[model samples]
Target: MAALFLTLLLLSSAAQSAERTLVFAAASMKDAVEAMARAYRERTGNPVVVSVASSGALARQIEAGAPADLFIAANPDWMDYLEDRKLIDVESRTNIAGNTLVVVTGDGAIAPPVDPEPLLRSGRFAMGDPAHVPAGVYTAQALDQLGLWEDLRPMAAFGENVRVAMALAARGDVAFAIVYGSDAELSEDVAVAYIFPPETHAPIVYPAALTANAHEDARDFYAFLRAQAADGALGPYGFTKPAAGSGS
Candidate 1:
């Protein structure tokens, strides 16, 4: 009888493991994704495991065989990297959401249309590392378009990801930071001081796809993302739904 009970326990454990879906997502999507995961769980009774970090970092991990079933990137570049390497299903890729860049301050007191020049002159400015981070790249482009890059680059403080940059400003480590509007919305310590003109940079879009070796079960979760996004689950978090019929 004891042997039969042990056998039943192991079978149950295996069944549970089989129902788990692993997702690798950019850090900025953390809050929205977690909420989606919970809703999915309530509806499907399947467990979802989420790993959030910089898009660059997560891409490297997936390349190194981290076993992610799906990936949601903050920018199209990282998704392109994986797709180019045949690490993701090209046909499965789709634009999921959109975001805007904003200059933020620690005290939520700074007003809109801020002049970053004077702000950066006396203190450090925080942003993601432009070498690979999307937010940093967008910030660089906007600053260059406004001809502020040459002057502001000197006082720039780099973070591994947008959230880290936002944290720097939120913690008073820097005078200001540029982060996704969604990120600033979630942080009480920070306020949007200025919104970067979309014309100054490439469109900010989030793309999601199944990994090359994605478990068949992961497909359901992938579909859930589309369904939830369509339902405007990300709206309250300050993310815009992808334009209808937009491809990755």
Candidate 2:
């Protein structure tokens, strides 16, 4: 009886300690989400597990059945990809934030009207894979909008994610990278060369949603972010509040 009681107590302790919410967020939101996780734990004692990566990669992971509690994508398209497959709770989905694109260099600010073609000819320009990564998708669209796509294609160095692309510039492997305004602040080595006009491509938006099988606590964490954003929790990290009618 004593041995059985001890075993039961251990199991109970394990179960209590195992309660955590898993969130898959876009790479660009890493700093903000990490900050939120710390605050959430202090307030509710419910730990949050945040996985950061490119929206495309995170969506693919979800499609392949990774056990994600929440999905906060850097763009709506990836969240749409999951929602179409019934992987997400559509009613819970909302645009949580917004960002803009920028071109930056590690060594110094490159003057704008930012003619990228000649710059690309002499140096490899970094971006997330324009085919899949949201930042890259936006970059490509903007380049096309500016008539720079066809000419600059050959000089592209694609990273699997936005941060990876920025790292190329951060590490001096590439001098320039087109990245989110939020993410550029992460690398001391890179400086903003040009801010892409919002009209250059589709507006950058971040949408968050619960998985269809999300933990009940997942909803709580989601709500906390919304509340805190209103209270300025997101401001320090360069996140902008979602505009009205843009909440998805």
Candidate 3:
């Protein structure tokens, strides 16, 4: 009877150890992070929960006292906002990767304009709402650099987020939409019209942090995300590791 009781206690402890939850991530990271979370759970025997939305919205939610074990943002600005509010563990904050912005059109759509300027002057374009989505800010900057912001502004259809912008382009509602290279890669239904030159806008860095309210298991998962072995996990999702000393 003593041996049986000890075995039951071990099993119970294992079950308890397998439970964990996380929240706060950008909308664009939903697909990749969800897959990563599933893999992490299987490997570590711990479950993970995620909340996805625009980084700006997530930041507002956290500032309003939402419970989040972790936060991953598409831009540094929002992460800095959280740090300033003392909502995240400063030591756990780091820029994990970067991504490119691209202009994409529906597959087999009319060939893209050689110069985006002509397209902007003639037809509708789609982009995320810059006030709320990181991708939109990047797109705005790119257009500004090209001297096309004012001209393109009139034809722009602003989606709630990058995903919505991509959907608009895929549906042929707009000639093209600005979205992350990774997002364009996810759907063969969309064909990339052009890659916004790196010099055209600020680099899009994805920074992650452990929320101050996180449990030990959540912190462990956060650490796992920063491990070198996790590079492969990030690559397929259109992320490239940031240079050492770059995130600071």
Best by TM-score: 1
All candidates: TM-score: 0.91, 0.90, 0.89
- Candidate 1, residues 87-131, lDDT tens digits: the string is 999999999899999989897676564565665465788999988
Q: Which stretches of candidate 2 lie over 4 Å from their true place?
A: 1-18, 110-122
Off by over 4 Å in 1: 1-18, 114-116, 120-122, 243-246
Report the C-alpha lDDT of model 2 over 1-248, residue by residue, as the tens digit. 99999999999987665478899999999999989989999988888999998998899999999999999999889999999999999999888888889887888766765565565455788999966789999999988998988888788899999999998988889768899988876667788877888887887889999999897787888899878877877777777776556648
Residue 160 local lDDT, model 1: 96
Query: 102 in model 3: Cα distance from truth in Å?
Result: 0.4
TM-score of model 3 relative to the true fold? 0.89
Task: State which candidate, 2 or 3, has the greater TM-score.
Answer: 2
Candidate 3 at residue 93, lDDT?
87
Off by over 4 Å in 3: 1-16, 107-114, 228-230, 243-245
lDDT winner between candidates 2 and 3: 2
- How close is each model in CA RMSD to the real structure? 2.5, 2.5, 2.8
User: lDDT at 128 for candidate 1?
Assistant: 92
Candidate 3 local accuracy as lDDT?
A: 0.83
**Backbone N/Cα/C clashes per model:** 0, 0, 0
